[model samples]
Every structure is written in structure tokens, then in C-alpha cells.
Target: MNRHESMLRIAASSDISVLLLGESGSGKEVAARFVHAHSKRAGGPFIALNCGAIAKGLTESILEGHRKGAFTGAVDERLGVVRSADHGTLFLDEIGEMPFEIQCKLLRILQERAVMPLGSCDPQPVDFRLICATNRNLRAEVHAGRFREDLYFRLNVFPVKIPPLREREDFNTIAQEIWKEIADHNPLNASEIALLSKRKWPGNVRQLKNVLQRYSLLKPYDITLGNVLTDEFSEPATVADTCTLYQAKSRRIAETPEWNLICSELSKNSGNKSVTAQKLGISRGCLNYQIRKHSS
Candidate 1:
């Protein structure tokens, strides 16, 4: 881990573009933020945009800004994302998902250090450090003709590969850390931590955090972590027990920060279920379950 940090620091010392390669939910964005926080542009803005989340047909206007009256819906001028990070860092998450058409424009901007906004013939100078992250293999994408080879070479200047959580050597420490962050008032014992370390954690750290969040929520109701893990809470409940559980869940959902986070993310994603689920680090099914349970 120290070695990884040193490598990131070395990359951060210069203005070289960084390409973070990792599995989803493996903390690639966190790593990107760390680089931005440590870089010379740390004092400047750190703009993050999920390439996959950008609405279709709005890529150019969103990334390069737009002049007023550039399009049918253009009523106001915009600064766009690339210009927004001038003198700072721009983190592009899920860069692999960026459309092939926009890739060329991005490469041109990087080469020229300027952006040509929509409906503008003049190119405006811009200065910013770029950090891109993705779970897909750019080489494979390039071979598949889905990604541009020139762009891949340009962005892979300082490649950093973050390993999945299950492969990490410090699972226990990570689990304990997440538990502290999410359920500090209800610390896990050594045995519990060991049990966590033994699991596959297919969803990586994000999944572990979700498990801890569920445990914390159910603890006050005398629910055991084991039951939570096994989804035993879904078993049939007696009439009295059902009423109690319903009341408890209603109050918890109302007060728990995660519920509000869900609503906020859902709104931000324009109510796109797949995007919202991915952003929240939960499965689509899990998101649907929460909606069914709380949307009433």
C-alpha cells in the first residue's frame, strides 16, 4: 500500500495524465481524488464527470460548454466540464464508456490544450490535469475497434492498476476501517471481523460497506449480523413482529442518511435505475427492494 501511494505521489508531482484501471467498486474514483488532492493543482477545482452518466447527444456541449443559442434548447451560456477544471484536475470516471465520436474531440483538446466550444469557431486555451478511470480494458476495446488507439496511448501515460478488494492483503484492516466509518458506535468484535475477512466480497469494498450499513441498522432491533447476511429478515413474521418491523423500518428509513442519499442520487441520475444502482454501489435488485419498501 505504501508503494502504491508512492507511485501515486510520483504521478501527482507532475502534470502527466493518469489512467486508473480497476474493477467497479474497487475505489478507482477514491484513488483519482487522492491524486488530485496531492497534485500541484490541489488548490484548484477538482471536477469529476462520469462518462457513462452523461446523457446521450449532450457529450460535446457538456464537455466543451456551449454558446448561447448553439442549439434548440440553448437559452444560456455554459462553461462545460473541461473548462470548469481549469488549473485544477478533471477526473473522468468510466472513460471506457465515453462514445467513440467524442473520444477524438477529447484527444484533440489534450493535444492542443484548448477547447472549441459548440457553435464557436475559436479555440479557447485551457489548463488542467487529467485523470481518467475505467473498469474496462482499453487495449481490448481498442482491438475491438470500440476505443481509439491514439487516445489510449495518450491517456495511458501513467497507468495505475488498483487490485480488487478480495485480492488485498489487508482485508481485516479494511473491514475494521469501514465498520468504524459506518458503524462506529457499534464496533465489531475480532470474531466478527474475522468472519468478514473470510467472505469473497464479490462486490469488493462497496459491498462490505453495504453489509456493515445493514448490520448497523438492524442491530438495535436485536437482529444478528448472521441473520442479516443470510437475508433471514425476509422470513415470515408473526402479526405482532411484522407490525413492529414495519414501524421500525419506516422510522429508520426516514432518519437514516442512506435513504436520503438514495433519493438524491436517483434524482441526480434522472431516475435511471441502472445508473442509480451503480452510483449507490448496490445491485439493481437491491435498489428495487429499497424502493418497494420505502417509496410508499
Candidate 2:
């Protein structure tokens, strides 16, 4: 089953803290948002914080809020993300980077259902579900004493592993969905999809999005696979003596009356820009440009 479907099933039945594990750009945050949207707390605030992005010294202040004059620049009292997410969900992205001391504090809150804000004498009760994401292997961190075992167990009550795009069966479906959203200004044709699907996308979804954006801006009218790979599609130098065979293929594409017709055929197969671009053996931008050019 797809990640969304699997997550939907989990969200409908559980209130356990969830841990979303995946590589960067693998849409772990998107999965977290989907879980929140599908859960009972859909109407409540869904606050997201990047644990690794926050500064080391200010981490406590950021998560637990600080009263006015709590620190050097504390001008006004502010609600920490934990308290603000009361009756809602808090998504902590990159939780593996959080300091061990902070993890201990977080474990206390989870165990006591209360938080002690900075510069505050009292501990306030809190009620919110927690979702944490990380790209690192926490088990490895635990071995090195960088992560707390008890905290890990508490947060990992229900773990959801978001598979990378390379392993996903719904890649084409998701690609088409993202393409429609991005290609509203410029439509794609058949040749583009074939070419796009053939490439090894190292950056996954983010890389795909960027390529489409660039294609839309650079060659909105006449994008083609050849145009996208013109600079990088060189033949192996060792086979230079026998390169005439490959050159013959290029000549065939150049001379054939069916070349444009083939592109048209591929475009019809997958109207999405990324897919079409893949089919055309070019970047999405090249396909987008060609589409605009042909349409115009």
C-alpha cells in the first residue's frame, strides 16, 4: 500500500506518539502533516518545529517559552511551542539532533503531562500528541550515548517509516499530482514523461520540483529531452571508434518524420511535466518550453 494509505490507517486508530523516519527530501514532514490532518486533532493547531535548526543555547526557550526578562533579549512573554500545541499536535522535525539535556526535559513532560516554562515558578499541564521525525539512525546514536533510550522509546510508541521515492510504488502517481500543481502555467506533452521517468532522481521529490520550476522558467514553450541533456549526454570516450553507431541513432532521430510524432505520443501517455520530460530524455524545463512553443 502507499504511504498515505498506511498512515491514514494508523491515524484513525491511535493516539500514541509517532516517529517518522526517512532520508532528507523524502517527504517526512508531509507525512506528519497528513497524519495530523487525518487524526482526531484535525481541527486543532498543528505546530511544527525543527529541533536541529534551533540554536543550542535557545533550545529550551524555544520549546518551553520564556517570560519577559527571562534572558538578555526577552522583551515579552511568549508561549513555548509545547504549550501552544495544547489540544493539538506538535511535530518535531530532526529530533535526532536535539541535545541530550533537552531530551531529558522532554521525557519529563511526556511522563508528567506538564511543562516548566523558562523563568516560571510553576509547571503547567499540557495535553497534545507528539510526532517526531529524524533522518539519522537513533539506534546508532543510542549506542554512542547521543540519544536517550527512554526518550526514544517514548517517542517511538508508533513508528512510521516513510520509504524513499526510489522504493515507492506510487512514484508516477505522486509525480503527476505534483506536476499538475506546478505546471498550471505551462502544460507538458508525451515525450517529456518518458524521458523524466528514466532518470535517477537523487534529490527525490524536491529535485523533481526544482527541475520542473526551472523548465517552466527557461523553456516554457519548446522543452525536449535532447535540449535538457545537450550538455551532459556525451558518449563514452573509449568507444569513440565505434561512436558512428550511436551517431547513426542521432541521425535517425534528426531525419525521421516520426520524431515529433513520437514526442506527441509520449506526451499523451503522461501529461505530467516531470513524466513527459523523462519520456523525452530531457529535463522538465526543456519539456515545458517545448510544450509552450508547440502550443503557441
Candidate 3:
């Protein structure tokens, strides 16, 4: 993230078109907005389009504008994204999914710096910095004849690759930053933080948010490694546990902030680790490890 931030800082000052390559939820759109906000075109309108979301027949008209009589439903003249974002930045997400027919028009728009609306006799000049993002491998798509090679070359001018969440060295810090978005407080302790770091968040930040949100929505929210890893807290509410999750059985003793109490338990059981572990409702190994940890 440090290196990526540094690149964003340097890239922000220039008007070079950028291609953001990363998995879904890996912050491509976030980076696109960042670049637009810091660029010279910051004062102008910032337009965004998701090519994948648009229907096949409407993609070109929506992006390149159309005259009132261009199509059956065209009652009013509408400006394309390029013209709408003239003198500004245009972010096209999921560019790989754009139909091949519209790709040629988009390429022309980039090369000629002009757009001709459907059924229009004149091509209007436009000026906008382009930023594109995609989770798919455009190179492979090009090799497979699904993407336009020339268009890919044009958009890949200032390529920026965002790393996956697990590969980021600042994992914990980033997770906490994301956690703060939906969480009112940072309730994760050191051990729990370490556990989350070790989790396999396949959906990246998106998955992590769902997970933490699930815990946060508990009858009485409590953040702990055991609660996060187990189904103990997700059980249906009962009269005895109406106000909160069953603390007696659902609460993991590891979250206890009393190291001295463990020592007392150890002494109370006459130094028998097995008896102490049973009384504390924790494994013997866990008790022993905690004993050694707090003793040191």
C-alpha cells in the first residue's frame, strides 16, 4: 500500500490515462476516484460507466450520445459519457465486458478526440482523461479474440496493478481502516487481530466486511476470535439469551482480560493443570500457553 500510495500521488498530478487491474473489491474504483480528484480536471464533471452493467444494444448510445431520433425511444438529445465528461475524467469499469461493436467506436473517440452521436452528421470534439478498471485479464481476452488489442493498448497506457488483500504487508492496518467504516469502535484485541490476519478472505475487503458486520449485528455485539471463527454466537435467540448472546456458553474465555484470575485458578486447583483447565472450560494446552505467556 505504501508503494501504491506513492504511485497514486505521482500519478495524480499527471493527466495520463490509467488502467486499474485488480480483483473485484480490491479498490480499483476507489483508486480511479482518487486520481480524478487530484488531477487538473478535478473541477470538471467526473463521469463513470460500468460497461458490463449496460445492455448490449444500449452501450454505444449511452457512451457516445445519440440524437433525439437516433432510435425508437430517443425522444430527447442525450450527451455521451465522453461529452458529458468533457474537460474532466471518465472512468469505465469492467471494460473487458464491453461489446466488440462499441469497442471500435470507443477507440475512435480516444484517437480522434471526437464523438459522433448516432444519426448525427457531425462529430463533436471532446476532451476527457480516461481511466479504466477491470478484474479480467484483457491480454488473455485479446489472445482469445474477445477483446480488441488496439483498445487494450490505448487504455493500458499507465497501468496500475492493485495487489490482493492477503499479499498486502499492511493487512491489519488496512483491515482496521475498513472495519472503522461500519464499526463504531475497534474492539478487536491483539490475538483476535492476529487471527483475522490469518483468515482466508477470498472476497477481499468485501468478504471481511460481511464477516465483521455479522458479528457486529449480534444481540449484544462482542468482537473476539472465537466469536468470529465459530457458529456459537449465531444461534437463534431464546428467553434466557434475549438481550445478548449466551455469555455463559458462547463467550470464549480467551477474551477474558484477567491474567491474574488464571493464576488464581491454577493455584486453586492445587497446581493441577488438567483440573484448572476443566474448571475454566478451556483446553489444557490453551491454559498452559496462557500461563507461560502471562508469566513471562
TM-score, every prediction: 0.76, 0.74, 0.73
Model 1: how far residue 27 lies from native, Å: 0.2
lDDT of 3 by residue, 1-296 (tens): 37776677678899888999988888888888889888888898889999888777777688888999988999999997889999999999999999888788889889999988998989899988999999999999999999999999999888888777777788888777766777665556687678778765667777677777765544232344466545432556577666353365345543543777888998898999889878877666557657755777
Output candidate 3 Cα RMSD: 10.6
Q: Model 1, 37-134: lDDT tens per residue? A: 88889999999999988886898888899999999999999989999999999999999999898899889989999988988999989999999999
Worst 10 residues of 3 by lDDT: 216-225
**TM-score, structure 2 vs. true:** 0.74
Ranking of candidates on TM-score, top first: 1, 2, 3
Q: Count the backbone clashes (under 3 Å) in each candidate.
A: 0, 37, 0
Candidate 3: pairs in clash: none
lDDT of each: 0.83, 0.74, 0.79
Candidate number of the best lDDT: 1
Which pairs of residues clash in candidate 1, taking residues 3 or more apart in a chain or in different chains? none
